[model samples]
Target: MVHNYVMRLNNLQRKIREEELDAYLVTAQDSIYYLTGATYDTAERPFFVVIYPDSPPDLVVPELERARMKKAQGIRVVQSYFDYPAAPGGNWYDKINALVGGISKLGVEPSIPAEISSKLWARDIVTYSLVSELRLIKTDDEIESIRQVARYADKGMALLVKNMYNGVSAVELLALSRQLQKEIVKAGDYDPLDNEFITVGRPAPQSAQPCSVPDYGDRLRRGPLSLVCTLRLAGYAAECARTVFLGPPSGSDAELFHHMETAREIAFSMIKPGTPCAEIDQATRDYFESQGLSEYILHRTGHGFGVGSHEAPWLSAGSKDVLEKNMVISIEPALYLRDTGGFRHSDTVLVTEDGYEPLTTYPATLAALTLKDRRPLKSLKGGFVRRAAGA
Candidate 1:
């Protein structure tokens, strides 16, 4: 998808003029990518995009990336330093100070490194998140890119479902994730460097720990299995997660899953333009509280995701951000029980003018997720089972 980098730069420049700043210096990699569509590995070197109120933005990079930056869209000038820790007058900080020397006031992102921000010699330096604010309302190109990413995430989930079997190991699932990633690259015109594809499988007991890395030795047992697919294509990201059962869920497990699904639907029903993010989260919390399972709730109802996996307009009790049209977010309200498994399903949702649209299309129903006829296979040689061999 071709992005309108010129329009994006114009938006940031307009913000710079509105704030009465001579120039706005962007240091965050993701923000730079959003504005310039330049993808590069920002190692220890300082990379920047300085936008002036009336002129085109200037990109600063290490000399190694000078040629690449020259070809990047929406940048009018490319300045480079020889390397990090260079001579007195040839360093990145030196170039930055020289670029803004004529300007009276400068704007910087809030996430700029303290060391870099402190070295700026501008008479007045103000911290702001202008680019991030612009990103809150995605453009047509961005929405399309995110939609494409959602498609890939859904495909990854579908692959997971097809490969899931009783006694499947985390190692095998991870290998499947790699295979799916390769398939996506071959199937689309995506830059391998500009995307990320990961699938995490956590079979129960470990599924209760959402952030814990699954044990390679852990195998799918007769309990809940949580699968998450996080995909990013051409700089936009989407996530899809579902909790399935290895076999028929026990009566208590099925009841808990029902509550989790109901809570997710409640949150989904509240998604629309102008809705308070907190209200959606509050409603989910209220439902869980009424069900006498509030303590099992682990995190917020959802959070916005775009260039970054987690971005603005968070859906939590304390967030003040309200949903706006075109803002993409994840609706993942999860419950974690000790000794039991996690119960959750996540979908990438787009806020429309009237309501919302779900981008990820994986089925979330228990009947659909349950592998009723699959049973644990007998222990194979070396305690390992290849997917094809298992079949």
Candidate 2:
């Protein structure tokens, strides 16, 4: 892990030189962790990593994180403040001034804090630059990390399905998903950086977007429910989404689902080296429109993901990003109908040398999605139980 950090810094240095930048200031949580092995949430607190072409890197963090930052290997100097608002004479500006005191040009990411930027005497070179592009391609070890998390997400989905029933409320379904994720983490002895998202409800009309969290009282019917799970393992991430049906699908629902599947197939088939990213999205949309399901389309095909769930090299119409080997992205083609529900299966895919490979292993077939029980579930309202699944 430490070696990976060193290589990434070296790469960033090269980019700095090419761009004629004197120094690069990084503040994004994911970018900081990607460059150095240090990880911490940036909630309310400011964090930064400064890299210079000629000088060793310096890290400015909260005093609380000072001990943790010590464990990180690539950084040469560690500076900390007791907390936010800064202590007397402990201003980060002074440390930064000392580091790049005489520099004539400085590079910074989009999210760099105003305080730091305002104090810089050098001309600011603002851009994502090497940081964003570096994350687009995953190393062999990074890909393996994502594979493990994808498996965990698959398990979480199975748990949700096993507990699903006709009358199960959206809230209950979400609870089950969380429980399963916790169990998987303990059983596997994995670090707990995993994130799980659950969406359950009847699909809304093409004009109406469904809320990620269902209505408090909305209960599942013998229709479609969308479940999406994203699990992060050691900072590498993968996602799995499936549209499940409570019972055997009706003829109409099956046909709509088939169109959804077709769109997904179109996107998957086009994944290869040098294929323009927008073309994949455009081709999928074209297929859906040709089938006359354009109204039901909600959003773009998918987006790039890694340490951050949504990153660079987005797969969407109007984007010029071209697919490259080791670039990880999600291919999700979905349809929404007022009467039926949402039909989507999002899979994390890797752009390989020859083609693509799906990191998510969950089956997306109709038969595989059919639930066995249509049993009524107990209703719970504001801390009170009003009914049960078997009753």
Candidate 3:
């Protein structure tokens, strides 16, 4: 594992050289994890990583993370600073002189707050925007952990859809979805969720507009089409979303939903190493335009996932980042109408040299209700999420 981890760091070093950068400063908490394997929130105190291409990287952190970095392997160099709220010069700025060694050009993640960047180093430290784009791809071990999380998300979403009988309160469904996510996380040997995403059937007859009503207490009913639902299982950062029908959907509903699914397929097929993200978005947009539904695309084609539910390497026209091997992304393309609800489907795809591998393996079955059919109609258990079939 450490061998692969070092190689990943080397890949970033190569990227740094190609970008004409001398070093990169990492402030995003997850970027710290990506580089150092020392998971930290970096909230209580400043945690920073200074990576110099072809040299041992330096980590600046409060004394709290000293032992943590020591154990991550290849972390031979680290600088620790202390915080004394009651004392002067208590901030980590003193270590700046020691940490910012020989870096003429610096690459920093834009996710770093402006305030943090302002104090990190000298005003003249030529800073370039450097997000951990390489982190978007999935390693075998990383994919395994996320697969567990996505499986849990799929089950949690399934539970939400299964209980979508008329008169079920949105709050009740949301509560149930949270409960299911808790169980799935627990099953994966992790604690209950600290962060998650759960949304129910939207409020639109034929259109997919933002819910004006607080979706918390609204009762879900059979609508003009299907429901846009999602459940994020733990901050392990797995996401599952789908447009499930309330009852049997009509022909028009099925046709549109399948079209949205097709858009998703086209986008997925377009992702691979070396493909520009703009072309992928254009293809999806062109397909939607061909279907005469160009105005309904509310957002980008997709976004990167892992460590956070949303991050860099966005799959949209605005992005110029090229896809690379091992990158995991969500190619979710949806059409939302103001008259009818939306049809949204997404899967977390791992970009491979050959093509792509979808880590999110939930079946896109129109007959999802059938899976719920076999289960007993007992009172809804607090946190019983049906696991994904193969998981």
TM-score of each: 0.94, 0.88, 0.78
- RMSD vs true structure, all candidates: 2.7, 3.7, 5.6
Error of 2 at 114 (Å): 4.9
Model 1 regions more than 4 Å off: 373-391
lDDT of each: 0.87, 0.74, 0.65
Worst 10 residues of 2 by lDDT: 382-391
Best by lDDT: 1
lDDT by residue for model 2 (1-391), tens? 2237888898888888888888888878888878876667677767878888756788988888888778555788888866666766566666666766677777888777777678765645566557987888888878877777777778777766776666666556555555655665677645453344443433333213434655545566666677767666677777788887877888987887788888888899999989998898888889888988888888889888788777878888888888899988999878887666788888888889999888887888989988877354433231242132221
Order of candidate numbers by lDDT, starting with the best: 1, 2, 3
Runs of candidate 3 exceeding 4 Å displacement: 1-4, 13-22, 63-73, 77-80, 84-87, 101-103, 128-131, 177-214, 224-236, 250-255, 272-274, 365-391
Clashing residue pair totals per candidate (backbone < 3 A)? 0, 6, 11
lDDT of 2 at 275: 90
The candidate with the higher TM-score, 1 or 2, is 1
Model 2: how far residue 132 lies from native, Å: 0.8
Q: List the residue pairs that clash in candidate 1.
A: none
Residue lDDT tens for model 1, 268-366: 999999999999999999999999999998899999888998999799999999999999999998899979989989999999999999999899999
